[model samples]
Every structure is written in structure tokens, then in C-alpha cells.
Target: MHRLLFMGTPDFSVPILRMLHEEGYTIVGVVTQPDRPVGRKRVLTPPPVKAEALRLGLPVIQPEKLRGSSELEEIKALAPDLIVTAAFGQILPKALLEVPKLGCINVHASLLPAYRGGAPIHQAVMDGCTETGVTIMYMAEKLDAGDIISQANETILPTDDTGMMFEKLSRTGENLLKETLPSILEGTNERIPQDEELVTFAKNISREQERIDWTRPGMDIHNQVRGLSPWPTAYTTFGDENVKIWKTEAMQTDSEGKPGEIIELTKEHILVKSGDDTAVAITELQPSGKKRMTASVFLNGTGSQWEKGDLFL
Candidate 1:
């Protein structure tokens, strides 16, 4: 078995770490980001990877900066043959990369040269791409520009949201890691450079990106709705109150109402006019300072104000 140091943080990286442990890879230690404050209590919490490492009785390191000479010295003393990283937030410096005998390998969630940076899975669905995949690459100084070691693709379903796509791609990446490690250890795997011209970047998502642009085409609005679901959800203003849109679906209509105007309202759905089409059936929502619930639930608390003819910013 090869000696390895695994680095990861979020839930997206957990599956691969579990896979590596089960495969008996001799993981010497795990490196993850320091705990973050979360929830109403403001309690500091260990990241998913740190928790997993603890559960498995494995050594873990939570360094605020890997570039610190002391941290680098500690890791180098382990004499790991390889460093495996998946969604570990910090950029790895060249000084640390040289510590591992076989270098580092990264499990990125998109087909390289395509969504090549942060939030790849979310950007893929938001862009309406027909397919997206995971890539296992040899890590380099640049961000996700390394030579590709292996890749696997999956089709994107029409109803797929960021949460669902993330689940799928995370597993796809885990399976790819399991299959590729053996070959890489034997020196048979090849790494190929990414096509520079085809490169596209996915910057970290912003709150502005979650604001529903009603002036845009219906499909574009719909994509944003799904892409941001369950976190920093798509939202708009209604009657000077923030209204979070948790779900939406397309509809055909000839109504010429202005964009952001509520064209119709029924017991089951709310039809909102957009640039080129209508968005019927926003099924769930959250009024400011309230928990998320079905549209019907929201209507009960603030009745009739959400009805037809009201404009949502």
C-alpha cells in the first residue's frame, strides 16, 4: 500500500476519503481547513473532513495556512509518497508540493478545460449544459490547469438542481479515484495538458448572481432558480419584502405583461411574466424572517398581496 496524505474539507470530499480508507491506502494524515463558526449559536465546528478523520481514528491537521514553515516541516516529516486533495480550499504552494514523493493528485468536479474553477457543478446546471463530468488530475501550481489523469461523464437531467448534481458528481469522482490510483502507482497512467483555448472559468458565486433577473429570458431565470436552491436561494422583492423563490417551472402563455409582473395566480401556482415566456408554478418560497414552505403556506400568512398584477423586483 502507498503512503498518502489526504486533504479535503466539505461534504463533497467525504466519499473519496471514505473510499481511500476502505481501500487500505495507508493514509498517514488528513489536512482540512480550520473549524468555521456556524448557525445561530455561533459555535465553531469542524469541517466535514476533520469530523470524518476523527471518526476513522486517523491523524488530522487543520492549518490556517499551509505555507507556514512549521506546518510544511511537520507534513514533510511524514514522508508520504503522495498527496491527494479534493475541494481543500487553499491553493497549494510549490514548496509543499515538492514534499510528496509522487506529487499531488486532485479530484475536480468538472471535465477540465470546461468549468475549470470554483462552483463547477452549479455553473454547469446554470448554463444548461447537457452533460458534466469529474476529472482526476495531477495537481500543479495553477488553479485546475494541470494535466488530466482521467475523466468520467454523466448526463444532466432537466429537473436536476445544484444539490442533486453535487451528489452525483461527488460519487463519480470517488469511483474514478478508486480506479485510477492503482494504475498511477504502477506508473502506467498518463497526464495530458488541457486545451487552453477551450478553457472557461467558474468564479465563486455571489449574492448578486442569486438575484432573479426578471428582465432576462424565462429559461435563464429558471436556471438561476435551480442553481442557487437550498443555499443563498434565488430571491426577489414583493411589496417591499424579500421573497425567496425555492422552486419554479416553465409555462407557455401569450400574455404581454411587463417582466416581473405577476400575470396570474391560482390555488396551485403563481405565473410570473419574464423576458420571453412565463414562469408558472413557483411551488415553494420563504418570506423574509420566516421558514421556507409551500406557496400555499406563504399565501395564508400574507394573503392576496401576492396575487396577480403585483410586480416582483
Candidate 2:
């Protein structure tokens, strides 16, 4: 069995870790980010991957920074054949990468030479991609610029949100890792160079991007809303109040009104006009300082009067 050291910090990394363990990989140690303060209590909370590692009785290391000589020494002591990283939340330094016999391999959530950055999944959905996939690549000094070892494609469902797509891609990534690692150990796999021309960067999402611009096309609005679902959700202001749009769909409507104007509101959908000849049916929303709920439910609870011509800023 190949000896490995795992480095990851999110739920996305959990499935791959479990799969490696079940397949009997020698996971000598796991490295993850330290606990962060979470929730109203401000209690320290371990990352999902770290929690899983502890539960599995794996040796866990939470290093604040991996660039230090002491940290490199600690990793060298493990004498791992390979280091596997997935969403580890830290840029690994060069010294530690050389410690492993097979070096580091990253399981990225995108087809290489495309969507190469922190938020590939969200960027794919926001750009309205028809399909995306996973890429297992040898870790290099640069950001996701390494040669690819393996890949698995996944179709992007029209109704898929980032949360749903992530769930699918995570599993796909795990299966690919399981298949690719053995071949890599046996020297049967080759690292194909990525196309530099096809490379696209997915910079981390910003709060400004989360602000829904109703002036855009209805489909753009709909895509942005769903793309950012469950995290920094696309939002807009109703006068002075913020409203996070959790779910919406584009539809053709006869209404000719200014963008952001509420065209219709019913139990099922809250229709809003857009500048590009369409309307969006907003089904779920989160009003300022309130939990997420249906638009109708939100309206019923607040008793705030909004009419067909009322515009959302």
C-alpha cells in the first residue's frame, strides 16, 4: 500500500478521504486548517475534514502556517510517499512539496486549463456552463497550473444550484482520485500539460457580485441568483432593505415595465421585470435580518405593502 498524507479543510474533501481509507490507503497523517470561531456563541469549530480525520482516529495536524522549517520537519518525519490535497484553504509552500516521494497531487473541481481558481464550481454555474468536471493534477509551485493526471466529466443540470453541483462533483472527484492514485503509484499515468490559452481564472467571489442587478437580462439574474445559492446569495435592495434571492427562474411575460419593478406576486411566484425582455419568477427569498422563506411567506409575515409597479433597487 502507498503511504499518503492528506491535506484538506472542507466537506468537499471528506468523501475522498473516506474513499481512500475504505480502499486501504496508508494515510499516515492529515493536515488541515485550524478551528475557526463560528455561530453566535463564537465557539471554536473544527473544519469538516479535520472533524472527520479525528473521528477516523487519524493523526491530525493543524498548522497555522506551513512555510516554516519546523512544519517541514514535522512533515518529513511522516515520510509519506504522496501528499493529497483538496480545498485545503492554504497555498502550500515549496519546501513541503518535496518531502513526499511522489510529491503532491491536487484534486481540483474543474476540467484543467479552465476555471482554475478558488471558486470554480460557482464560476461555472454563473457563466452558465453546460458541463464541468474534476481534474487530478500534480501539485506545482503555481496555482492549478500543473499537468493533469486524470479527469471525470459531469453534466450541469439546468436546475442545478451550486450546492447540488458541488455534491455531484465531490463524489465524482473521489471516484477519480481512487482510480488515479493506484495508476500513479505504478507509474502507468502520464501528466499531460494543460493548454495555457484555454486557462480561465475564477477569482474568489465578492460581496459586490452577490448584489443582483435587475437591469441585466432575466436569465443572467436567474443564473447569478442560483449560482451563489446557499452562500453570499445574490441580493438586491427594496428601497433601504436588503433581500437575498435564493431561488428564481426566467420566464417570458407580457408585462412591459422598468427593470426591478414587481410585475406580479402570487402564492407560487413573485414576478419581476428585467430590461432584456423577460421576467424572473422569484420563488424563495430572505428578507433583511430574517431567515429564508418563500416570497409569499415573507410578504405575509412582514405585511409590507408592495404593488405591481413597486421597484426593487
Candidate 3:
């Protein structure tokens, strides 16, 4: 068994670590991002990978920054034969990348030379991409710009959200890596250079991107809502309060009013006109400083304050 150092830091990376253990891989050590304060309570929390690594009885290292830190020295001491990373959350330093004899590889969420950055899955859904996939590639000093080892495709269903696609791609990558690692260890793996012209980025999501742009088409708004759903949700301003839109459906019917205008209201949903002359049905939302609720709950409760013609600003 090869001495493999597994590095990753989220729910998406858990399955890969589990698969390695289940398959009886020689995982020498696990490297993950340091515990950070999370959520409303701001309590310190261990990353998903760290918890899993501990359960597997593997030594774990949590570095605030791996490059030029003592943690890098600690990782080197493990003398891993290879380093496999999945959403490890930080770029590996040149020194660390050169340590492993079999070299470092990543199970990236997107296809090579496309969506090659931190938020690939989220960006794919936000762009309304019909398909996305996983790539197993060598880890370079550059971000996700590595020689391809293997890949597997996955469909992005129309209703799929970031959370859903994240799970799908994570599993896909796990399987692809499982199949590819054998050839790599045997020194028979193929290394295809990425086409630089096809390179695109999926940088981390920002505050500005979370604001609902009512001027866009219904499908665009719908994709945006779903892309950000279940985390850092898409939001719109109503009066002085911000309402996070958790679920919305693009309507086929043409708009009956100006963009952002409340075209219709019922117990089940609120229909707002979009810039494409179509509409979106908002069925789930969370008012500022409040828990998420059904559209009907909002309609009968505090949302009753607004009527047709009110703007979703």
C-alpha cells in the first residue's frame, strides 16, 4: 500500500476520505484547515475532514496557513508517497508540492481548464450550466492548472442547487480517483496538459453576487436563487428589510407587470415580474433576522403588508 496523505476540509471531501479508509488505503496523515468560528453563536468548530480523520484514527494537522508555516514541516515529516487533496481550501506551497514522490493530485469539482477555482460547483449552477464534472489532476503551484489524470461527467438537473451538485460531484470525483489511483501508483498514468485557452475561473462568491437582480430574466433569477440556495442565499430588499429568497421557480407565462413588481399574490406563492417579460414564483423565503418560512406563511402573516404593485426592490 502506498503511503497517501489525504488533505481536504468539508462535507464534500468526507466521502473521499471514507472511501480511502474503506478500501484500506495507507493514509499516512490527514491535512485540513484549522478550526474556525462558525454560525450565529460564533463557536469554534472543527472542519468536517478533521472530525472524520480523527474517527479513522489518523494523525491530523490543522494549519492556519500551510505555506512557510511549521505545519508544512510537520506534513513533510510524514514522508508521504503521494498527497491527494479534495477541497482542501488552500493552495499548496511549492515546497510541499515537491515533497511527495508520486506527486500531489487533486479531486477537483469541475472539468479541467474550466471553472478552475474555489467555487466551481456553485458557479456552474449559477451560470445555469447544463452539465459539470470532476477531474483528477496533478497539483501544480498554480490553482487547479494541473495535468489531467482522469475525469467523469455529471448532469446538472434544472432544479439542482449548489448543495445537490456538490454532493453529486464529490461522489463522482471519489469514484474517478478510486479508478485512476491504481494507474498512477503503477507509473502508467496519462498526463494530458490543460488547454490554457479553455481556462475559466469560479472564484469565491461575494456579497454583491448574493443580491437578487430583478432586472434579469426569470431563468437567470431562478438559477441565481438556486445556485446560492441553502447557503448565503439570494436576497431582495422589501421596504427596509432584507428577505432571503430560498426557493423560486421560473414561470413560462409572460410578465403582467414591470420588473420586480408584484404581479400576483396567492396563499401559495408570490409572483414577481422579471426583466425577460416572464415571472418567478417565490415559494420560500426568510425575512431579515427571522427564520425561513413558506410563502403562504409570509402572505398571511407579516407579508400581508405588501400588495400587488409593491416592488421587490
Among residues 3 or more apart in sequence or in different chains, the pairs in candidate 3 whose N, CA or C atoms overlap within 3 Å are none
| TM-score ranking, high to low | 3, 2, 1
**Clash totals for all candidate models:** 0, 0, 0
Alpha-carbon lDDT, every model? 0.87, 0.89, 0.92
The C-alpha TM-scores of every prediction are: 0.96, 0.96, 0.98
Report the lDDT tens digits of candidate 2 across residue range 1-313.
Answer: 7889999998999999989889988999999988999977999999999899989999998888888747667877999999999999888888877788787999999998898889999999998898999999998889999999999999989899999988999999999998898888888898899999999999899999999888999988888988999776899999899888999989998888999999998877789999787799999998888888988787676724777889988
Per-residue lDDT tens digits for candidate 1, residues 1-313, read 6899999999999999999999888999999999999987989999999999999999988888988757777878888999999999888999888887788999998999898888898898889887999999998898999999999998889898888888899999999999999988887998889999999988888989988888888888888888887675899898778889998887878988888998888776688999886565577888888888887776666655666788888
Ten contiguous residues minimizing lDDT sum, candidate 3: 250-259
Cα displacement (Å) at residue 273, model 1: 1.0
Residue-wise C-alpha lDDT for candidate 3, range 16-50, written one tens digit per residue: 99999998989999999999999899999999999
User: Comparing candidate 1 with candidate 3, which one achieves the higher lDDT?
Assistant: 3
RMSD of each: 1.4, 1.4, 1.0
Model 1 misplaced stretches (Cα beyond 4 Å)? none
Q: Which candidate number has the best lDDT?
A: 3
Q: By lDDT, highest first, what's the ranking?
A: 3, 2, 1
